[model samples]
Target: MLEHWSSSEVDPSIRLDYWRDVAHNWVDVQPLSPGDALEASWSLLRGENCFFGTKRSTAYEMRTSPRHVPPGEDMVVISLLEAGEMRLNAAPGEHQHATAGMLGLYAPRQEACYHWGEGARQTYVALPRSVVLAALGREPGNLLLTPQRCALAPALAAQLAHLGLLARQPGRVSAVEYAGLLDATRALALLTLRNLGRQGEAADLPDLEENLHAGRHAAALRFMEQHAHRQGLDAAVIARGAGCSRTRLYEAFAAQGQTVMGALRELRLQRARAFVEHSPRLHVGALSWRCGFADPSDFSKLFRARFGLSPTEWHRRVWMEPALRRGA
Candidate 1:
């Protein structure tokens, strides 16, 4: 299926809202400058296992927020920047830039923020994360594939640009041909990953059955990380978010010697630890509530058990140690 969207078709007052509606299928979008004239258009070609398209847009930011996190769309995006620039902050203190002609890779399942410059044009392919994992024999961490990093990047960029052209005339392509295109693109993508020395040979890659099983766990973990702070988060909610059965969820986590609820608690504690480290002035009771703990005392026990110190003790130690050392 091929679909097109244009900001010109909508009223000027609602163009940003319309763009948000369209882009929300993949990432939640917000304007960088409120009330700026947003101009954008794109055509998308969807096949059985992949989506290919090109988008040209003015300055805006797209993000993945915890509340906006959807259940399961385990996909990786490969973008071939044709013009302008992109800034990505995929994690705290980690920023990357991709200029025109660079190939960018990121997992939509993870939290990220993407910024596009004015008149940014890019041809992109979104494929199931499992497919890319199988192709690379492992997960591809987010990065830009510069011509220097991967000799095949230039060729891959050209192929992606051609995909955008094909998307413009989707009716002329038959289903079988579309499938073939995806297969070929997957092959090229694999080469790019390997060329960057991301993984070993095809023989080292996990078999199809194992990759499918692990993919479920990976998807579930992604969901857990995003929603760990919710008070009612439980096994059933996680299973639903992962798009898997409760039994499957249990099996997936058990394979790593972890339990559903146990994992959730650990995630919460980890989040709490981060809060303690960053905001030592925050009361432990308030921090406990923010991290989904019902009782501040219980939260302190868990925090101490996990980190060898109560939240208050840990916070004081972390913040005061430098001062103490400086005095010494």
Candidate 2:
């Protein structure tokens, strides 16, 4: 489920107060520049394995105290800034600056202060520290995962952005798919951290490139699965969503002996088959439209070619199996 909060719904005079109250569990929000005229929105999907979300706000400052955090919560926040600028300071003379496309790993248990410019937009995910430890065999330190620091950081950032997209369309994700995403995210993050820790001294760089492509492939699959219901969904959109170029996306799919449109058609057919199996009385035309087919006849033709029977025949077969066996 996605939870959303915005200062727009509150009275102008009390918007800041409301945001501060609403966000008290994590940090104390303050209007830093363009004072008191607060405009910010936060949306989060708190999954069983991880929390993924996005935040959009005007210029603001956030301070976290030790008391604000739970006594023993062991989790890390990974943020990818999409727009504007940010300054994060966790201790004296320990300041990190970020701009668009920069990824940062943050320790929530530590007291910290964050300041960002107007129109700041970011996507983030929070996962248990154990996930990192299990993959990296050590606790992750707070630092920016930039291209200069880690070659795999861009791919990991792309995965985080993909999670943000999936969070926006929660209905498209199943428990199994969500678990798959969590696993991919954990793997990518840990690989990035491992690479970052090595500081460009790794003896085996091919492994990192392989994992980057794998991460991109998994991200593209999730994006396609979520947007398959749209008739216009194609390779370009898939490439953008997966944070790779059209050539790279094609190469990834081709490496597995798959085509982008073929995979999309398969996804649509699978969904249509599920509906036909369950909704016995639903109309074929409506089902076809729901599954992104522009023409019912075309849908039927493809369905028959794939399943060796038309949807109606498949439906009949599904419902008649038990009765036919009983008669036998």
Candidate 3:
């Protein structure tokens, strides 16, 4: 069932106090903007595995402390910005900005403040920290991600938005359907992290023994993708990050007809191609270095072998063809 509260529904004289009390029931929040015209609304739905909600309000900052946090609530809040802008102070002197199409991950027991600009609208999912950690294989400290930066982020955001819509129509969903939605949500979250190259941190898996080998292989791949920008990244480093023996890591890749270094090279080349396609102003030498190639000659040779053209040629063709078509 969804529960909703709006400051407009309350008497004018007590709106401030009423809004504070309502916000306190969910999380530790403090209103930074004050006036009789304070307009805000919050709607939330509780599920067996998570809580989904949408909030719209004026400017406010979050205050999370032992005294302010609700007792027995251990959750990681995943928030997506729908409108306006938000500034997150994850730690002293550390600030990050989140705008529309961006998602923020807030860990449990972490001290962070969220500042929203005027007329901010945000949708969030609150799930147990244990569940999130299990899915991610590690704790991903407060992170702000732009969906456009990763291939899987857009799908994840769409899934979350759909879940929010379902939450609002509780009567239309069955218990079994809700459980399926939760499973899909968790899987999408994990896929997003993996695609962003942020997964693969060592995690304790008490019941995943049967899938350990496959898990290790997947972790190694993600680790390589995440660190492909480092010139010194290699097979041994990938094995160490995946917490597996070098020989086993090699066998894992061989199963897919690939070698560890071969996979890393391909990933780097793919990134270089993406950069060339998206950034027309970047020079070939700079692009090669940014993609972790120590020598531009080697980069040029590899680019030609992979894409049938040198980096410069590919860039010019991709960027110029569009303009030529438009001119015609």
Candidate 4:
């Protein structure tokens, strides 16, 4: 859809070539342009009649009431911008110069024109009136812009890159692959709506919370890995790095149902035990200090409590390389 219309002031043409089974009456084509507007072409993809489009505004000025949508034709239009700025008039307040994010709504059958700053890249999604009413549980006029934070925005960026790549490829993709693309676009729409607080209430699955855990836990693990050598590394600092309260951080681990302190101690002692086992001559006391234990006696005591043997004894038993202990 990035085809440049002309080198001169010619505006890019709107190409809506795919219209076979739209599951609706006429789509009511609207140019959504201003007299001052230059280039404007939108690439279209339809999933079960829902439309996904990307448009670029080669504009460079402000406009007052540049366009409007009449109140009749039923459709919802959404906008996701890769970069650049635009001012949007909607409920709550006007959005100014938003980059790398999304803004969208039910079309509400009225002319709409945006005042954009220079050339801007935008992605659009069009949903049928029935779909919007089903999702919004209200009339088009009542369906205003809502605060939506889609995590899939990053994923959508990736999806766009993949689409661009496929289009650039030498040969036409198989029908199966094309079908997959359509399905993916729909999935992206549903995902975006879910992120934007448009979807029906979910049951609040804990597995869905996996991302939260992954985000926080990965950071915590990386921090612990990097500073495992420090004797002062503890729960509070890890919590700070993970951007979680100490109690919340503790609960995150506890959700996994693992004892945080116990896990930490085991990890340290496990490393110390491995070092001692691998190097037949590595000093036990030195290994203890290296793994962040301030004193070898405390390390040995914990090691015995954990493994039913002191660090040195455990090392001796494992260093013998018995066939049963070879996995160590």
Best-fitting candidate, scored by TM-score? 1
* Model 1 lDDT-worst window of ten: 89-98
Off by over 4 Å in 2: 17-24, 33-35, 90-94, 133-139, 166-183, 198-328
For candidate 1, the TM-score is 0.54
- Report the Cα lDDT for candidate 1: 0.75
* Model 4: worst 10 consecutive residues (lDDT sum): 15-24
By lDDT, highest first, what's the ranking? 1, 2, 3, 4
Q: Sort every candidate by TM-score, greatest first.
A: 1, 2, 3, 4
Could you tell me how far off, in angstroms, the CA of residue 72 lies in candidate 1 after the best superposition?
Answer: 2.9
How many clashes show up per model?
0, 0, 0, 10
**Poorest 10 consecutive residues by lDDT, candidate 2:** 88-97
Q: In candidate 2, what are the lDDT values of residues 230-291, reduced to their tens digit?
A: 87888999999999999888877665455777777877887898898787575899999999
> Worst ten-residue run, lDDT, model 3?
198-207
Q: Distance (Å) between predicted and true CA of 143, model 2?
A: 0.8
**Top candidate when judged by lDDT against the true structure:** 1
How does candidate 4 score on lDDT? 0.53
Model 3 misplaced stretches (Cα beyond 4 Å): 20-27, 90-94, 147-151, 165-183, 190-328
Better candidate number, 2 or 4, judged by lDDT: 2
Quote the positional error of residue 21 for candidate 1 in Å.
3.0
TM-score per prediction, in order, is 0.54, 0.52, 0.52, 0.40
lDDT of 3: 0.71
